[model samples]
Target: MSSVYILEPPTSGKVLLKTTVGDIDVELWAKETPKTCRNFIQLCLEGYYDNTIFHRVVKGFIAQGGDPNGDGTGGESIYGEPFKDEFHQRLRFTRRGLLAMANGGKDDNGSQFFFTLGATPELQDKHTIFGKITGDTIFNMLKLEDGLIRDERPIYPHKIIKTEVLNNPFADIQPRLRQVEVKEKKKKEKKPGVKNFKLLSFGEEAEEDEEESTRVNEKFVGKGKSTHDVLDDPKLSSKTEDVDEENDDVEEVNPEEQLESIRKKLKREHKKPVPTSTTTAEPIDTYESFLEEERREKKKKQFEEIQKEIQNVKKEYHKNKLKKKEEDIIATEKKVQEDKTIQEYKDEFDKYKNKKDALPKKGAGREQFTLNLLEKFKKKIQSMKDGEENEEDNEEEQAWLKHRLCFQDKNPVLAKDANRKDDDWFEIYDPRNALNKRRRGETVEKFKK
Candidate 1:
């Protein structure tokens, strides 16, 4: 008998899930799976399950949903990441309507949940059972399951429209709700071409707006003209010609005078560099070279050490493998020697040897019987030896086959040849076969015919 974490049905801690199909009242197992219950309740209070559809549903199995992505890959816990699974011996998916967290692996529980449509013993210890459908609301879960198509998705979107917390056991503890930051939608900016356009109203208002539109169009008329057209205008073209002629009359300066003034200005702006002693410069260069050489030596030493470590590790691994093989061989030999049939044969041979030693040497019939018994013993011993040899041969064949498979796996061409169904045993053994012909210094094309 197992210890029961939940002795009675939970009355206070319950949640009302109003879905598109019908409402489902689930009682939380707060005592058994507190963290899982808390997470579910917090998500409900935050309205995370709202409008989320039951993405997966299977007849006589489960109805899974609560994924904000509407598929199965979204929704996080109240903690913002996957939480640890809370499994109780007593709290299991033994009956229908049990609520459990769906996870990818161990301790990977998220906000996605499932309702067991029937007894699911396989999922007992795997998923964390946090709640169970109470009262007649279990029929609603069945209704959702019934509405599923061949792909396990509902024909119509059976969405969880609202989630209301009817009773909160951890209400005094203050729910640890994740702070969801509402993203503000960016306002679209009007295009530059449409910015100056004004809306025209109808009737008497349209006449007044038309006058305003005329004024606006006139203001933007020059803005629409291209730069090339503006420059080609008669008034602008004449002004540009006058400016060019005026620039041609300006006096030119002597190149030698300009160069002299620039040199004087540069001399005032910059100062001369002071010369350093040769002795100081030489030591600095030598010291830098020495440091570089030391660094190179250190790197070389580290590389050598790493190579040695790798060799040592390889040697250790090989030694362990060889040791394990030797131990296995010894164990098999011991088992063969200690077999009941072999022990029985040994006992019978010992008894016969004692009887032969005690018998009188006069009777020919007694001697013939002893001879026949010895012959039978010899045959039995030979057969045992042959059996052991056969077993050894089988072991060798298995090992060779395993090695061949591994080799084929490494080479795709070999793998394809091994997988070919057309090749028969005779073809493999035949000297006229392509591979055999090639190996025996004959043309493969000649053998193909």
Candidate 2:
């Protein structure tokens, strides 16, 4: 049941206009919006749109056309009744492939409209979109944005050389959160003579036109009588004012002076002063911006300080631990080297010693160690002269060893031990004991001699 403005299966009702870069085929949307579409289609059939150019090109945005003067303000029907706004339920200004009406504000729509060079889905639900461009010239126009003008175009020089509204001139424009210039409602009027809201023109053109002897009196068809031969005068149609936006069949704006007067009313309601900071002590905007900058700088400084502190803590912690470890290692090595007796070696050896079995005993196992066990029996070896050799335990042990060796007491006691338990083995306490023990047979022979 919805009245959608879609192109039929070869998908549209239009003739294709080929360009050097691409083709331009427009599918009209009159089916969805009858009046608005009819107006544009009539103008096309009248040869009114021919030789007009894309007066303004915005990169990544739109390329405006339908201006005979190559200046933005020049398009008007033979008489100047701006077309009534067709708020269609079916069509929208949704994307880049759109061909929509362009207005100064509100009902200011004239013969001039714009075409989207690419997809702009973000523009949906807003502007009074009438149709879409159906051909490849969409691409050709896209490249025009980059030619000499990066983002904005010349409203003066680039004009559409020839135009053919080949088929359906009523197309749907994709819509969106549109700018003030593209809005559907009336805007507050500007302070009279404050700024040029009408079509923008160079001051030089006005001077030259005035100097010409022949005055241009070309009157637009539907608009009221006036001397607006050049077409770019930024005026609105008086007939199109205050029409119900929700209704499809509303009257268009005409009667220029009346439209201008109503605009004056709206202007009074919405007028605003020029934008500037209002601060008693200092400019509010400048001070706020300055404070924000200072806060950022403070944060940066704090971050650097924290980073440096973290590095220093890590370095100091590692340095102290390394220093203490080195000192401890040096001290332990010095202690080991300064030890006199090979105490470490002896201690290791004695760890498994069977002390009861290794103690010196008399006769068979004992005295060859030459430790003089008699002295150790009770620590009686007080001096080398009156030592334990003269003690009773020493004399007895020495007698027992001599009986075995068959040596007289006059012979130096090579070794001696206490006459003790039979289970113990004699352990050598003196270095000489080892040599004498090994030379047991020789020692006996020498003693006999």
TM-scores, each model vs. reference: 0.40, 0.32
**Over 4 Å off in model 1, which ranges?**
1-12, 173-449
Return the number of clashes found in candidate 2: 49
For model 1 the TM-score comes to 0.40
For residues 1-449, write the lDDT of model 1, one tens digit per residue: 12332553454489999997789999988988888988899888888899999889888999899899998989888776888988776676667888899999998988999999988888867899888888899887788866437688777768899999998888654555558799999999987763322353345676667677677678668576444443446544322334544446667899999999999988977766667766643455778899999999999999999999999999999999999999999999889877867898888789779967978677897789789879865764575555532343344235535421111235445334655666563333786677786788876565578
Which predicted model would earn the best lDDT?
1
Per-residue lDDT of 115-232 in model 2, one digit per residue for the tens? 7765565555434576666555566656556556533665343544444556553454222232447658878988766433235467667556655523443334455654444454
Give the local distance difference test score of model 2.
Answer: 0.61
Taken over the whole model, the C-alpha lDDT of each candidate is 0.79, 0.61
The segments of candidate 2 whose C-alpha lies over 4 angstroms from its true place after superposition are 1-22, 118-126, 155-158, 168-449
